[model samples]
Target chain A: MTYRTGTEAFIQGVRTLIPLTPGVIPFGLVTGVMAIEMGMSPGMSMGMTVLFYSGSAQLVALQLLQNGAVPVAVVVTALIINLRFIMYSASLAPYLHHLPRRWTWPVSYMLSDQSYALCAVKFSSGELGRFAPHFYAGTAGAMWLTWQLSVLAGVYLGASIPQTWSLSFAVPLSFLALLVPNIRGAASLGAAVVGGLIAVFAVTLPYNLGLVTASVGGVIAGLLIESIRKKALSNASTNDVEREAQ
Target chain B: MSDLSLWGMFLAVGIGTFVMRLSFVEIYGRWRIPTLLSRALVYVPPSVLASLVLPAVVYPHGQGAFVFDNPQIPAAIVAAWIAWKTRSTVLTLALGMAVLWGVKVIAS
Candidate 1:
């Protein structure tokens, strides 16, 4: 548990994320394969996998491209879809504050759901020290390497796969897999219903703007419902306390 | 999409995503984010994920564009249930893809 060397922390980080790679490889391959099916050049797809390093946003952009969306819409939708990274950044900021720009920026480039979730817990537990950044970088770098290789294989294999199998269907299927685990709260349900409704009705809009609109609407609905539900629960508790006091 | 436009989209997304990921850590590493923004950020996952997943499941094409009675709808519902029940990404992908291919073959 005492990680003295950066290499030790790095190894520890890589080990921590090993369990999660099973999930990452499939999703990464799917994104790569989908990019090819959706009309992306192999180079662009690979570049995207490298530059963006975000499976969800890359998939969203490819989907938008397939619909002949304008660049603005494609980029905007992808960024919005990736907005969670901001929160991850905020949470990890304190842990990274000690590092200088040269160290922090490169490490920041490696920030991801796995790295953030894993390192955040490590830092919060008051366990890691100066080596936290190296640990995070190690995890991120490992994930990045695995991700790039998977996507390359996927793009190449996706080209050889026959059209009759309809492999492109995996795109939505992967998304369904992502969505199902997240659908727990009233907020999520409300967001899905509202967003789905809007998406269905707004499909005809130019630039694939409907997707962005639905996403924004869904976020609003979820937040609104969540706040209201929380207020109601708090009020109910207060009322019970008042009755007891009386 | 033109090469220029495609590359432009890539640059925009790549830069935007990086900026977002780096922002709090590099730019505002010392700043304390407001409680409200953090709370709202929690809802982003569900909302954006639903927005992305639903249309693909419901339409299976660019909104109202369908050929040969979309099989994805039923497949998605089954996959969704499995996703909720198991919460394993691999399982969900397997079941979802199987159902989709299964529906397509049976319908044909």
Candidate 2:
């Protein structure tokens, strides 16, 4: 839908994000609860939350910290988890580069998986016109508010809960939820399998280096499978041409 | 584990992450990303996430040993299946937690 004014587009952006909030709220709450449960003071929990502004990275950092991982390892692993943001930044750069530094800086900082997904679709459709950035700000701003408030709620609610609930398992479960949707083809599936197996075998690695190793191995496996598939398709096409000539 | 250390780690990651998010936007015209790197970026999420999920589920207690009978294994499987089918984070988490609790209750 075309918007005559920036406000209309911004409102539309917020509306588009509402449906996705249900998926986000639980993760936010889990991140908050996990942080507090890891013995972080509420003040510190909010500090990390606001600083990182990333649920997956925050959770992974917490998990590594709980495992007695070194600070350097925790930082590396968390940064690795947030690497996908680089891809998002690249994808949205063309659309956002014309904006001022002030707009570009905060907009990039507010980039989340959900906001990227929403904005990518809108930008590609080329419907938002001059207000594309405004629409993005709408979605990103709403998402930011929703995330912080949900996490804040969880922080307050995290205490007084018994330890028997095994709430920590939700961390990995959330990762699994994120993982499944990414496995769309054979290459990605191979990547995940290799990555998972390597992690399990390398669990004994010090400083949580297994995660780094597995991630690299998985990406390499995916590249290998992708090239192999391409070669097979080319070979089959060549065979078809030879038969036609015969 | 001290407050100072924790904040340091947070600052490091925060700065690093922001730089990454701003990388292309800051230099879009000055630099072109390598074609191979762009292609491989698609696999990063799956690889990293699986790497994280598998270990967490297989070795629930972080004992550095995989336990075949870990309740988290089955719970994670069910959750993975639910995630694939529903693609709903809330549902996946709700069912996974419920399954873990149910399995624990039954086993005890």
Candidate 3:
């Protein structure tokens, strides 16, 4: 629970992130391949990769562009997909707010779902103490390096990778791995079920709006279930007290 | 889209995303997060991830149509089970890809 120094905590963070890199590598490779297949030059593809630093959003934008969608639509949809970062930013703010701008700015820019997931619980538990930011930086730095290098490899190896490999499926598979761990309680379970079903039923929506809708629906479902469970618990306690009075 | 236009779009998205990422961190002490919004934030990862995973699996091509015989559904189910049991990302991905390739071969 304690570390000798920030360097030790940072190394620990990097070590923990190593296991998740397997899930990340294929997704990054697929993104790189898809961008090239869509006729983007290697320089342009890397430019998008470095700029976006988001695999899913970048992939979605590339798909939209390949379909000849308007430039405005591509930009909007990508931004919408990146909306979850705002939630991550808010969640992490309390833990990281005290750091100076030099530390906070780059750390914010490097935030990703993987790093946030790793750090959120650690930060909340107050286990890392003063070295928490260093640990976070370690995870984010490793993830950034892993992603950029894998995508670069994919770009160079593009077209030669056979379609029969079905690498795109790896994207969902990795998400499943991440999703299973996040379902820690009934509330989170409700959120996942509602979100997934809505997405399944709303796949026909334009501009990939179904994703946004499904996410909102799922969060609301979770909140509703959580409040209901809380009320039931309170009522049961009150009834117990009344019986004791009798 | 032309090269210039494509770059412009990327820049727009990149800047927008950066702002969102910095939104709360930049103003953290200035404004407190409301209790309700903070509570809702806990569900964001599960809901958003499930939203992405389900659609991608059910509609393998990102097309709206759903098919009962899709290999991805079963592959995903198996992978989910493995992930739950093992909690190993490497193992889950490796087995999931293996299952998908096996199913495709058998179906053909």
Chain B TM-score, model 2, reads: 0.95
Write candidate 3's Cα lDDT for A4-95 as tens digits: 89999889989989988977887787788878777789999999998999987887687667646678768876786677798889889998
lDDT of candidate 1 over A1-246, digit per residue (tens): 558899999998898888988888888888888888877789988988878888888887777777677778878888887888988998888888678888888888888888887888788776887788788888888888888888998898777777777666677777777766556667777877888788777878777878878877887887787767767877465553222111
For candidate 3, give the docking quality class from DockQ: medium
DockQ for every prediction shown: 0.58, 0.64, 0.57
- Lowest summed lDDT across 10 adjacent residues in model 3 chain A is found at A237-246
The superposed Cα distance between candidate 2 and the true structure at residue A73, in angstroms, equals 0.4
What lDDT tens digits, residue by residue, belong to model 2 across residues A13-43? 8998999999989988998898899999999
Q: Candidate 2 clashing pairs?
A: none
Q: Rank the candidates by TM-score, best first.
A: 2, 1, 3
TM-score of each: 0.92, 0.95, 0.82
Q: List candidate 1 segments past 4 Å from native.
A: A235-246, B66-68
User: Candidate 1, clashing residue pairs?
Assistant: none
Better of 1 and 3 by lDDT: 3
- lDDT of every predicted structure (CA atoms): 0.78, 0.89, 0.83
Chain A structural similarity (TM-score) per candidate? 0.91, 0.94, 0.76
